[model samples]
Target: MKNYDVVIVGACTAGTYFAHLLAKEGLKVLVIDKDSEQNLCKRLDIFHFTRDSYDQFDIPVSGDGDAEWVHDFDLCLSKSALDNHPKKSHTKVAVMHLPLFIKRLRERAISAGVEFHFEESFVDVVYNDQKQVCGITTTKGYYDARLVVDASGIPSVVRRKIEDDYIESFEITPRDKFYVLLKYVQLNNPDDKVELSTSWPYYKGWIAPQHNKSGAIIGVGANISYDYAYKCMDKFEKAIKLPEYTLQYEEKGCTPYCRPPLSFVTDGFMVIGDAACLTKPWNGEGIPSAWVQCTPAAKVVAKALSDGKIATKEDLWDINVLYQRGEGAEYAGTRAMLIGAVNMSAKDNDYLFANDIVFCDDDKGPNPNVVGTLLKGVFSGKFSLGGLISLMSASNKGEKLKKHYQKYPESPAGYHKWAKTALKLWKKVGTMADTVKDA
Candidate 1:
């Protein structure tokens, strides 16, 4: 019957960040995870944190000239780079060795008096008579807290505990793509420095290096159904021609993108990171949105607690409203855009290459990097029209007609709204497929 101010389930990247932030504010925090401590610490994949973020968190970039966390895409994009790029281009990003990075955050939280519990799984969620989440029942014991933060990832325990209506508060759901990644492969040129290379295919993941002279080769893709992805995965290994020098330390699973609940707080409880589905809906990039969105979530939670207002699902709805106003809205919009592109044509891989509209190369030369190409396209506003048409066509004819009906608005709002509505409608179409049994 021990009680804490806050109990955080799942100590992964976003969970680590949330705990550290909450603990720093003098909240009594306990972080629990099902994974072994060593396994959690050994996660070495490149998790990105946006630039300007280090200043927010008070963590300095690594001073080691070689340990640079922030890299200027402009400096290294290609021999040929574009003159103008999308606003997303100038945004500097920090890519970290997630395990070590998380360890540092955890250490800081611990120093600030946060408790850590490992190898414990949260088996059930506790609810009071009001149907508000009170705490969690874990393998170790039933721990009560004034607030519970479920960062347990997509298959969320706290979310499951709530009624289905409560679960669907944000009106979002999962898509059919999952990412199977190969981690920690040493290349033949172990001595060589790691550079960004999108040429390695399968929707182009990433090449992340470790201090131990080893690196990881990652790949990602969308538009492929989940069942087909297993076969596609076999082909991915073959496509990459995974080097013999590449030692497979770990293979990991991730949702290709998560359509997170718009708001994650409910009566006396809140969720963060994957538990809330704070993942990107298109590229599976959860780290940026997680960090960007956490500050607001924390603010609301802290405010509710200090104001002596019992957090309620209605309050959670308000919090979701707050989130949707910021990066959350942009993420939703971006997802709609990408899904529209995907539905345009299965063969359309416009994001993978530079098009004629935005063909400007870097002053130096054509840097075969994908960012270079992507930036060029973004600046030119040369999105895949074919993709747009294809996506709309795939939706029910009724949905398409609804969009057309809205097309007469003076501005572009109608288009965006129509696209969002159509995306939801299309998702409903796929749900029927989910009911079909596997042979």
Candidate 2:
């Protein structure tokens, strides 16, 4: 058996980045993927990465001449259902080819001393006498490792195979996922070329610049399935005016939209990236968010594995604390609030946009009299009473969940009690899937 310090399944963005970080910590890391190197990350040809994230994560920036680089845009605009009340936000973003970007990440990981084995699919996890995960069985053969990390995206191959009390093996159901469909289209009018990303939150749709100067990508994500997403796109196009374009091609993908497992670690095992549902509640972007967990996790895992000490749940508990108290808490509240916020009528949505409420881009911050404004809207008949009540209830529940997460347990001894309360709170907070309207 080939022995390694850590065996990571899935060699995409999350796996390669984590492997590079861990290998830099002087651990022997090995990454395996079911797809060949040429085929990895080919599902999506083009994707966006915030320019500042490269510096924040210490990642190499792809320049204009680089194979991965397409172009950069500085503004993202969000509009109401009626196409009024456009909210503009500024952040430079790099457009890149996904497969080439993954190739770049892989090269970095290799330079950091991580081994890569393409075309090796995970079969199952190998457990020790104590029932702790010790290695993994792949289609090719068995490999022994002290730590096993699952960055296996949505399928969560390795994580789903683990039957442990600490780990939740629940499958990410259709309702718990965002099915995204992207249409690559060429603008009919040369003057109407897409230059920046623009989104309509009501439709969960956006049109962004593509690699070709005259081409753009129109995308929509919805619960249930790709068919539902297409239905949403049809509604969006009818409700708002868009530049005429000729369709070139289409691509589809899915991202986990549900809350992540409360615990991301167990004895000699950890799960990160999409496998752990580490995505932004607002946008369904997983790369930077997953790295947020990976930064602290690498430190904790490195320390636990130092001096050849066997890593246990007790030793890995800090990873949960660090994340749950920080980004996890923030996302919990935002996710909860969004469920109710998006459930309003199109007229009420336009009213909120006009009043600079939830969809506002005010640089000053949230309006202090938000409740008063909602009450005013209710009195003016601009908003429904039931909608107001639902929004308030969801906001209150979100705040409570955030507070509870901030008090995350510091050790395994206090975990079960904390988790029990968290589950109850999340049940009340609800999910984005709850906002899906009947087709």
Q: Residue 279 in model 1: shift from native, Å?
A: 1.7
Cα lDDT tens digits, model 1, 247-328, are 6575556553545553465577777776676766545667656766676666656655665445665544545555655555
Candidate 2 per-residue lDDT over residues 157-249, each given as its tens digit: 888888987889989999999999999999999899799999988888899999999999998999998889899889988998889999999
Candidate 1 lDDT for residue 385: 48
C-alpha RMSD of candidate 1: 8.1
Residue pair clashes in candidate 2:
none
Q: What local distance difference test score does each model get?
A: 0.55, 0.90
- Root-mean-square deviation of every model: 8.1, 1.1
Best by TM-score: 2
